[model samples]
Target: MTERETTYEAPQGEGRDRQPAGQASPAERSVGDSVFHRHERAVDEVPDQPAVIAPGEKYQLSSAGRRWRIGEIFKLLRKYEVWNDITPVRLRCLLEELGPIFVKMGQILANRSEILPQRFCDELRKLRTDVDPVPYTIVRDCLHAEYRRPLSEVFSWIDEEPLGSASLAQVHRARLVTGEDVAVKVQRPGAQQVMAQDIDIMRSIVRLASHFVQTDQFVDLHDVVEELWESFREETNFIMEARNLDDFYEFHLGTKGISCPRPYMKLCTEHVVVMDYVDGVSISDPDALIDAGYSLKQLGSRIVEDYSTQVLDDGFFHADPHAGNIIVKDGVVYFIDLGMVGRMSNHDRLIVKDIIYSVAEGDVPKLKDSLLRFAVSRGDSGALDHAAFLSDLDYIVADFAGLDLKDLDIGEFLTSLVNLARKNDVELPSVVTMFARGMVTLEGLLSEYMPHVNMIQIIRSHIANEKSTYKRLEDGARELSVESLRAARGTLEAAEHIGLATRMLTRGQLKVNTQIMGSEEVLRHVGGIVDRMSMSIVIAGLFIGSSVVYYAKIEPVIFGIPVIGFLGYASALILALGLGREIWRNGHARK
Candidate 1:
């Protein structure tokens, strides 16, 4: 409602923004036209233009995007490379300068096959969240704004330089007035607004891509963007992350040597998070960990086992456990950054357990069966060559067959297996993919930390724990209980039916007619009579209403005639034609 704000309504057909008259919109041109007509109608409403910055010119500040201008950003990128690269390199560069929302969007875009080219994705995968820190004055100002007090009153001393900088927030080391050292994560000013705007852009991107691309086999592109939006919202809210840390710590409480950061939640807010400061070498640095007398092999196994417990045992696990998010100090592993987490239900956990079991056991037939059963889409089971798939799966797990753990790359192996599954028209869940990616990330860190670490043994041990005899017995008992109830109910129902049949036969009152709808003709005429009578009355009303309106000359006329009267006449005409068509169809049926 503000005069300063701008809105862009999509131009209808024949408008400048519409596609050329003969050209079909995305829905009309989609591979599966039978997908849905409503989808086509919706897609046709969008302006036939992508908002991406075009080559050889600065980005156009469209009405919807006019709130923020990036002419300076585009100018800076033009220094290293021209605008015509047709690569995501420039886009990635621009996103880095634009801040957190753009950075998150770039990260999400890496997986969007429908909207982004693979090459662009390849370049974007290299994008990192190592942004520059704001000045100490800004941090001080933020603290003042949040607490409504001076920084000196809250903190005894705070570091001017940030410990590390990321897309949404930057971390700083500080000491509380009470003398406890803590890490302060300060959210960028106006970050929520920027994130909201970028999510709106992402929605537009996904909707546009859905019109033309086929991403239905695994995940819906729009749904993925929506998930990312929700994730962004959670990540931005520091209070939510504090709760995650607390919950994760509670889940692993009393477990030997495994830990997550403890939050001082009273001092936390939507914009700032304060947690106990932890001093440890990054897990990626194996030399430091080894020099500090920590066992790399033990660390690797313990971490994987912990995640395994989180996934199968607890049904909740950190989704993002990259090397950067993990730390090792004095033989203890600490998981950090609890923004993105994944949760599974008991049923999903069972499916994952079977998957891990089959893969670790290297049982090709069992693996194939589990994959087919667990996949989100089991496409054309009959069309799949089960023997060939099993053979291929055997080759895929050939590395896992032996216990030479150092040479085996578990992450790559799992990815290949999932890729093979996809090729065979088996689509797995998002959690499955996330789990594999997390494993791959851990594998890289483990390999770097301890080249000879036997992760296979650890993973197998944890999986064995998941597939314990007690769990099997419990599951069997549960199934048996349900089956017994169902069978008992069936027996009782059968006896009742038998008793009724006996009474009917004894009384000589049993009657049966095998033919379905024996009275179809009479019912059909009766229904037809009712339908025609209603249609006739409605049509007559329409005609009479139109005549009355035309004679009365109602106000707000269209083309020298009342619009309502014209609509009434059009409705009557349509109904009469429909009636005539129905009669003709019925006559043909009779003939």
Candidate 2:
């Protein structure tokens, strides 16, 4: 089998010149010149001196100072006509210049074509965190600090050349003194601190931007930032990743055709991880895999089946299963990079199964119920229009009904479902979004290997085969029992409340307060109508009284009319004209 290629390749410069240790590579220099060089002077103006302040104070000061400096530099650039219109390339370059946190943000946005344009998403997909490898001295220092031992005590031979280098960490090939080949992943020095600081800055920026930007139309920016921090925290913790690897290894112990790296727990720490060195051909290289006597179709099917089991049955899954993260050795598929994983609760897993089953059966009502159960209401659940939500689901179901199993795109379907939920004022859990992105990525990787593989069909079949009729009936009975008990409890509570209310009413102690939305305006409008009606009644009474006075001759006559009748007639005329003028004014105001 062909050995797996290096995880990242440094961009080649003109003539492919090499750089010495502790210096920037040609690629890094070019990037800095384009983005940072222009604003170097402005950035230098900010004092970098340490101060005696509280932890929170220090963080606030640092984040605020950085934000202000960035804003100033951007303003200066714009004023000087040094910046151009932001295109896809410029945006990616800017994110790179902004640092790893922003680069991760851009990468996340790359998969979100529903929110961004296709071209932008395509361009962002090219975003890579590959930088010059950390110097060997720094790498040695990190290992010594983590292990607290001499190099000879652990590894007999360690390669200075990095297998891969990313923003968060770098991996190198090594052999243990015990004669075992292993891979050493060292977390970059100060990576955690920089990430924490950048995350704070990101939160501050998002909070400030929320005032002028409406992100409810898409995903919440605040949630996005928080999720980014959570992911960063998980990915940077090497111990956690080692634990994940152990769990995954155990889960697949007896399973065939799937494997993952086994970490050496004794050697793993927050700053470093050591695991088995996987020597295999990357699944991305189809020709090499074929040459190694592996059937592409079989590999794709096996991967899909295993992934389905990971999600639906195990409730734990490899969140990022891109081409680079997968490899093949002797017909066995290996999943590496256990740093980032997703987990779902049992309840969520069952709901997801129901969703898939409903879609397969073309049952719209069941699909709606499953989605609503899976979704979270941002506000009052009672406020949602069930009718409209059901209507939208019907349209989505109809659109999918016509597509054949092979023609169905599971990623697109899930995205549409998520978008519909968002439009109806409901939000799915973050895990669901992550799963959707993972599925899309996995599909893209398998598009060439297995064009006829239907993920939805496979999942549906898995669900069916996993549950027997007896099991299904047992589950139904359990659910029915729970719902029946809840209903009984609710009914009893209602009766007791009604009896209490009746007693209060008999004793004249019952009080009811009703609050209507927009009540102030409603009440004001009602009061105005009442005033107008009262004024009309008074004017009519005056007219009738005046006519009666004139007929009865109650006062001294003036020009064949009683004096009181004449005064009443004048008053009524003035009042009527005033009411007319007020009506006209109100009408014009409304218009």
Candidate 3:
């Protein structure tokens, strides 16, 4: 659901290259990132570090997962070796050659222009996920393998050419014997195996990179990659995707202004899927949509409501709602590629609804408590600085606070809140992050359709309508009564305990007991300090010892330096720097 600029004029596009800071690009205006980039300079000739793979020692690099043999590596490298210069385009080409996993990574990077250099993002955007379709004969073999019959028995006329080709599969237009036009998705031969091997290669890279990088934070590199792998696994399962499509299609069958394609469960298998053929227009193309005589405002309103209902009301949402995954068909928005979806329990949906209501009401303390409820806390959560949290929330909500009700943006507020949550010891599910990002993409998608629609007003209207629903009224009353009874029972128990304590004090029958307990918090702090000190001393000793060894001019010298001594010195240098930084942070905190 991450946003990527499709064309030059869309809200989130290459306008960063031309727009000044005062007159920001539509993307930066919509969302702010501190490290955002501008591809203002000519970039085709800009030099970049070529990604090289030197086959290292077997024990460290050549594990069971890394099946990249020496010959295969060299062959892949040679394809891009034009005068030994590996340009960004060549890098993208190499990723394509490597496999679909790498291409998926490239597509992800193409959207992170803020984190990555603009030149790299531009070239990686050209990394094609859609490749040449597998031969028709091979496709026929796959279909036959799935059905154990000749293709002629099912399809009256299957086009020799694929209608669309993607990383894992290709779609072919066909007519079933029943005279129904259908799209058949055939998995590429050995696509699963290739992706598995690529994931192995990625794991090795992450392992090596973590040693030299500070990768510990709210997100872990390995976990992130594994999550991506899980997503890919879901997408590769055609049967699961067919089920998802069916669920969505059924959910919105009678809904106006939007729909999902129908899936044929009978024709689905692990490798192939049959669904209704939708010859649709890219939602990114505004002129065509306008020429079709569809009101952009009406379409945009429907799109926003569809997603809000999925997330806030239904709690079952399309996790990836980027422009490419959506299409315009006969004045209705048709959603495709239902491999990845997000679902929340009724309780989670209630918490999210409360959060939105809190924001709308400008109740910062209530919002903080509602958000903190989802966060995991130890003994010190009550000790959380309420003032600090309130300040942060106020800053986050400033855009919408005291605004003309018609101009507020609930999506931006949600995105900001999610990003702010991670740094403050607030633990949230990945699906929440995905939902927030999907909202951001939804905004960019609808900007072309309707520039003036206020999402906050829509959210408010939805909540008001929900409050008046009979089901909600019954639920609210039941919950309130239950909570009140629990509170009263707890109060009576506390009064009884106090009466017993008073009686014991009057009779002098309560024995006084006292013991000093070491605080786990303080002990942990001291232990961390001692650990840093020990590491610092060890690193210093290593540096001094290595210096002595080097001065003695010992054996195994390389480039006029002892190899072992050089290694020790490098290790000590990194550790000493880290120690210094840690000390500085602690000292600064004390001040």
State the number of backbone clashes in model 1.
1
* lDDT for position 244 in model 1: 89
lDDT of 2 by residue, 1-591 (tens): 211122112233311123335543332333323323322333345334312335563223354545554674475446544356667876777666556777888877776665667788778766778776766656765665555445667877777778888877889888888888899998776565556666877787788887788667323567668888989888888999999999889999998989998899999987789999988999878899889888888888899999998998888899888888899987789999888888999999989888877777789989988888887764445476677788899898888867888888888788788878877877788889888878877887887556766777787788878889999899999999999999999999999999999999999999999866446788999999999999999999999999999999986998889999999999999999999999999999999
**Highest TM-score scorer:** 2
- How many clashes (backbone atoms < 3 Å, residues ≥3 apart in a chain or on different chains) does model 3 have? 0
**Global local distance difference test of model 1:** 0.70
Q: Candidate 3, residues 223-321: lDDT per residue as tens digits? A: 557766877788788999999999889888778867877889999987788999888887777688888887777777777788878887778789777
Which candidate has the highest lDDT of all?
A: 2
Q: Output the TM-score of candidate 1.
A: 0.61
Cα-based TM-score, every candidate: 0.61, 0.71, 0.65
Task: Point out where model 2 deviates above 4 Å.
Answer: 1-85, 214-219, 380-382, 468-591
TM-score of 3: 0.65
Winner by TM-score between candidate 3 and candidate 1: 3
Off by over 4 Å in 3: 1-99, 103-128, 208-219, 372-394, 398-411, 467-591
- Taking the tens digit of each residue's C-alpha lDDT, what string does model 1 give over 1-591? 431112111223323122221222221123113222322343456435322224432212244442342343355457546446645777777667665666766665665544567788667756778755555545555665565444656777666567887766778888888889899998755455455655666677667776777666324456556666777877988998999888888998988888888899988987789998999999878778778888777787788888878877888888778788999766678999988877788888877767666766777787887777766766755456576678778887775666465566777676677667766667777777667666766666666666666666676677666557988799889999999999999999999999998999999988877844346678889999799889999999999999999999997797889999999999999999999899899989999
Error of 2 at 2 (Å): 38
